[model samples]
Target: MTSNPPIPMRPIRTAQSRFPWHHFSMRFSSTPRGARLARRLAGERLDAWGVPYGSDTHDTVTLIVAELSANAVSHGLVPGRDFRLRLSAEGTTLRVEVTDTRGEKVPALVEPSDNLDGGGEGGRGLLLVAALADRWGWYPCADGPGKTVWAVCSASVLAAPSP
Candidate 1:
């Protein structure tokens, strides 16, 4: 009996595999203006990636960028340090990440019953992020002294019929 060589098992590619294009990143000052610019540029980048303005994905991502960027400015700001905004699209998922130099002020998820509105000054941004994003979390910056907050929103999924 002849022994046959084992067949190679190739990795399967799903709908998420055939990526056409998806990546964006930029640095901004740790200020309110920088936060606003982050949101604007993120929208433009999504438009360039075929997500278009006024689309659900575009709006959701833009909001996420705004909230995270604002958090970086308000809670994570360190004088003279700049924050970074990174956008990535994989499959039907769009990820928004904002990094700042203040890792000590890590974000916390507030309960619906929490006094987000009663506090007055602020504290509702992450709540908005939680409501809109499919998933979100944060981690310490890999190469520096800070943290990167990230959120993911589902995109292009509802725009088309699934097989």
Candidate 2:
């Protein structure tokens, strides 16, 4: 009797492999109310994605969204245009991106000392984003006259156990 060659075993797939990634995108008016709505919705979405509402991951992402959205509304606003918020989770990272029509008004990370010395009440948005996000930056939108500010939170923060 001839013995047939044994078949190779396939690697087992994890839960992440089954779902791959999650994404959310929405356009909001370039207004403070709109920014507030974006932040609330972002937290809700994160909670749905297994990052509990009060978890570090959820709070960090939502705060990033709030800052970026506020910047878009405050600095990147163009009359009759709206800002866009996009969130995506893949692998062990969660990325938050906010896009606005005014590409020329790029955000800068002002030194905290400079703002404090000047008695300024603002200009600290990017500073907070840099502190909370593992990485953050901006790029011109490919399909439109705008810029997208993005921040990423890695598993180091995202892996925190739910309380």
Candidate 3:
């Protein structure tokens, strides 16, 4: 009779455990064009972080960026000032942040139905953000006279091994 040696046990690593933190930040003009650019750049950055274009994680993050950027341009715009976009990924979490120099105009999440019933063309951005993001909020910027709106979405795909 032959006896096989016991196989050595190894700790299993999850997708969240294997992924390292990644960050991207940039400032854009407080204009419609700048907002568009921010969304495009965010998509590219997600691709670089292994989130892949067209994936759910990629799309969600991009949409959040688009909405936040648009709000910054339309509501938070300060002449001669630019807005800032920051993206950070750690494990299964992806965070999107948009900062503009308008501390007075804080965002609020209102019922979407209310706006739609009134035949309003806008005012649903925050509602969409609330639906899509696992968690979101805003705070006054620590270093400047402005505010930063942020949202976080869970990206299970971020844990998948890169092909």
Maximum-TM-score candidate? 2
TM-score of each predicted structure versus truth: 0.79, 0.83, 0.82
Give per-residue lDDT, candidate 2, residue 50: 70
In model 3, the runs with Cα more than 4 Å from the true position are 1-14, 112-119, 155-163
Q: How many angstroms is residue 81 displaced in model 1 relative to the true structure, after the best TM-score fit?
A: 0.5
Task: Assess candidate 1 and give its TM-score to the true structure.
Answer: 0.79
**Mind giving the per-residue lDDT tens digits that candidate 3 earns over 67-159?**
999999999999999999999877678899999999999899775554555566678899989888989999999897999999988754333
For model 1, how does the per-residue alpha-carbon lDDT over 18-53 read when each residue is reduced to its tens digit?
Answer: 234377789999888999999998987776666668
- lDDT by residue (tens digit), candidate 2, 82-121: 9999999777788999999998987899875555555667
Pairs with steric clashes in candidate 1: none
Per-model lDDT:
0.79, 0.84, 0.84
Worst 10 residues of 3 by lDDT: 4-13
Candidate 3 deviation (Cα RMSD): 11.9
lDDT agreement of model 1 with the native: 0.79
Candidate 1 residue 68 Cα shift, in angstroms, is: 0.2
| C-alpha lDDT (0 to 100) for residue 43 of candidate 3 | 92
Order of models, best TM-score first: 2, 3, 1
